[model samples]
Target chain A: MTALPKPQTLSLTVNSKPVSMPVPQGVSMQEFLHEWLGLTGARMGCGQGICNACTVMVEEPGKLPREVRTCITGAHWFEGKTVRTVEGHARQNADGSLTLSPVQQAFVEGFAFQCGYCTPGFVTAATVLIERLRAAPVPREAVERVVSEALDPHICRCTGYVRYHTAVRDLVLATPGLVTA
Target chain B: MRTFLLTLAGLAIGGTALAGLVFSGALNRSVVSRTVETPLTAEQIKALAPQGAKVAAAADCYACHTARGGAPWAGGMPFETPFGVIHATNISPSREGIGGWSRAEFHRALRDGIAPGGRHLYPAMPYTSYRGMTEGDVDALFAYMTTRTPMPVGNAKNGLAFPFDQRWTLAAWNFLNLPASVAEPNPERSELWNRGRYVTEALGHCGECHTPRDLTQGLRTSKALTGAVIEGLEAPDITPAGLTHMGFSAASLATFMGSGLSAQGAATHQMFDVVHFSTRHMDRADLLAMAAYFFDRDALTDEAPAVLPEPAPVAADVAARAQATYAGLCAGCHGAMGEGIPHVSVAMRGNASLRTASPSGFVRAVLAGLPAQSFPDGERMEAMPSFAADLDDAAMADLTNWMRAEWGGQAPTVQTRDVAAVRATLTTRHAAGD
Candidate 1:
């Protein structure tokens, strides 16, 4: 048997909390988030980069946003970085009650999921889409194109696509002054 | 020892240098140096190319085109079907490929079903779905192919036997069947809906396998997304009812397309192939658009209208003939009503197994006795009997046809030749597997 390398201690921000964990040499961001931290927001579908179920945003201090697939990406790649996941979308109020993010609310209201397996991935992707659309509201015709382009990496098998489309459309329309009637 | 180490280091350095040379294109020149290859300037290639041609090339048009060799687009790659094999032709610049083809002819070949030679290219080329591609995209695909390093090769001969090999018969087949002409997206629908329809119906070609086929192997448009068996496993209905059957929502469908998994079930087999090839690259919005169309489309209300209903009570003469054959051959195991004996035989009537798309299976079941199995419960079941020596093709066809007509359910006729062809192919497949 080959002698395995010693585990490395790493610190990273997940859902805004700085957490430390022992990461193996080839551990992926998704595995770390899911197995070690118990954050099941990022799904594991096709471990290859093809499926976007493991997509997560790496927040850097001053660089352009980069979306990485946690499944294929190594945990070491997230060292000293803040990663946002579906869990980060909700907030706890002063009274200890949680409020759903607009994107998450839109998904529920739009009836976006049937089996709910691919729901988290879609939510994560929609969060990213909403952020990008806020920076620059796209034309109504371009919304579908942009959303498709943005979510091209994720896969869903149920509901076909109507509800997901409606979810994104609702999110975009709800954004203040972003979408004109 | 020192000298050996030094020599090893030198060899490693040389290998890295050689790899760099190959990576940088220096080795490319040496490899092609002896070939009569006149390199065209990038500008020249671009100028001569039609729009969207480059994209088509990237889509791996050559993978199928150059399989057998000929002019590109001449058609001759063998695409295996449940019925038989269909070959793709060479789509080249030669007269056989597209040499004499006009722009309109080329457009028809790409977007329409008409070939330059006025023949209808089989749906195997996916022109049925490719028809939805914008004129610009089609133009680019044409330009890209014409500009390729044209190789002189002949079209591969089709492997189909008589009756199946008749190309002229395809014309009538196309007229009677084939998908409808591509229609522009309705402006009344959302932009997302339009784009989704464009990608799914055209570039994605989801229906090729998902949609059920008629007797002639053409897509049954009226029963779109109802369900069909492709390759071997059933392509589940993506229609709302089918979705409901599987308990998948519109969002779940989009997610599955985007990621190849849902909470309900992970994609397996041919679906995995589809997800990897097509859905993986589709954007979420486009996936949603496809989902939208699928969910909103009407359910398959028209039951296979072509299939005749079950024949009334078997004719007395036919019953007597069938009874004699059944008693002498089958009654020992299968009970009198065709209700198979428990732990001994499989019922012929109302059995899903008998009503499958390929009648060849039933023929095989009859020709080869069913194999015995030892169940976990310790119950032993007898194998089905083989009738190859006992029954001819006509008898087998008649029996199975009667079984379908009498006991199985409403389905179209199964020709004797269809049974024969399936038998031959099954033997070949079984031999290959061994």
Candidate 2:
């Protein structure tokens, strides 16, 4: 019998937590996060690259920020990169109780989800959007423009677009001292 | 409070305008530049084209004409339909591939079902729906295609065996029902309506499945969007009459077109493929436009009046026959009253799945049965047994007819010939792993 190949392990930071997992060759980042780590937040609506449901931020030190589709991307390709998921936002308070992040809170309050299947994707995308906006709070015209751009890849079947727009808008509006101008 | 109100109003208006501007500009940009020149110069046509062209190339067109490795677009793809198998011609740049044809001839092929040589192409080419394409886009596609390196693949002669192979009859069929120059959308309608019309007619090719076909295989305009079974898959009626429980509002249809999962049902089969390629890439406004046009069409007109159908009294013989079949096969899972078990049996009566125009699904369910499901919601899991091996065609037909007539549905009777044809096709496709 032929000798079994040695398994390879890669170290990566997920949602700010350092984790190491053994991954086979050609395993996508989406598969690695979903199957190996049990993070089902990223949905696989369409296996093709066209649907952006599996978008994830890949953070590499001293490099431009990159957003990659976990489904198409191989786990070995993200050997040392930090990845964030919707589960990462459940923050522990000073007293040790978990609190929902602002993006999560906004989503719930806005009644954004209908079927709630695509909700996690929206939350993660909104988290990214909020971070981007805080760095540069765009003009009101730009706000709509930016929101559309940020949410373009996400596909939501039930709530139509009204609730998603409402949630994102509310999140941006709630940011104190942020000016429309 | 006053200051906040004013600010909010101003922001809303400004945001709407800016968003509109950006979307319109993006659409215009995509429209204006049809071809993108890449650095690499591969002689292969598919290699040189952009992503959209590649997707278009991978379409059903490449399966046949190019099967024998002849010049691209030189028609030689053979399509087997209920009528017969017809060979597709060469569409490449060679003398055989419309080398002498002008832009009008190409447009005629797409929109009017007419070839450059003034011959009528079979409806299998989908020219009826393709004609809905905008003149400019069609021209661009032609330009991009002609620029590609021409292959010398020869055409395959049609394998059609008899009276069915007579090509002249296709002309009469075209004359009777060919779409007249891709009917221009009512200009007075909203931009969304116009866009939807273009997408539905040209790009989406909804008629390829939704519209019922005549005996000659031409689309029956009278029953447009009524829904039909294409390639074993039942293309659900997309009209607002809402055959399925999920009644699609214009907005909901737009969302479904964009995402594939609607409140009605998850996109499967060819629709799933369409969403994967075409609709998902569409901008929200375009999707909305398609929704607006479709929802506004006469196809949405309801056939059922305010009053429900008068309950049909089951004939003693019919009832006994149906009862025996149901008891032996289905009653174990679906309760005797047809109320259905919580997660096991789907009720035969009044179920939207049973009411669809195409009976292929119902027949398939009775013959081959539903696939096992282990979905998260226990409520969603359901299965049916295949009776193909067990029940004869007559018994299956009687059972289905009984279900429809007894279950408050207005669906017509299904013939055994239809069932046999669909079964044969299904078997061939299964064997081919299509």
TM-score of each: 0.39, 0.44
Listed per candidate, the RMSD to the true structure in angstroms reads 27.0, 26.3
Error of 2 at B219 (Å): 2.6
Give the per-residue lDDT digits (tens) of candidate 1, residues A62-174.
Answer: 54344666765567657788988878878999999999998788877878888877777777777777765666677777777777766665688774367887778767866
RMSD of 1: 27.0
Instruction: List chain A TM-scores, every candidate, in order.
Output: 0.90, 0.85
Question: How does model 1 fare in lDDT?
Answer: 0.62
Kindly give the stretch of ten consecutive residues in candidate 2 chain A with the minimal lDDT sum: A63-72
Candidate 2 local lDDT, A1-181, one digit each (tens): 6444345687889989888877664456677788889988877765533355776765556543334556544566566778877677779889999899887787778777888767667776777777656655777766776777777767887845778887787678768644355
After aligning candidate 2 to the native by TM-score, how far in Å is the CA of B38 from where it should be?
A: 24
Weakest lDDT window of 10 consecutive positions for candidate 1 chain A: A58-67
Looking at model 1, residue B202 earns an lDDT score of: 69
Candidate 2 stretches with Cα past 4 Å from truth are: A1-181, B1-78, B87-104, B147-152, B161-171, B179-181, B229-234, B242-246, B268-284, B297-358, B365-434
What is the Å distance of residue B176 in model 1 from its true position?
Answer: 1.3
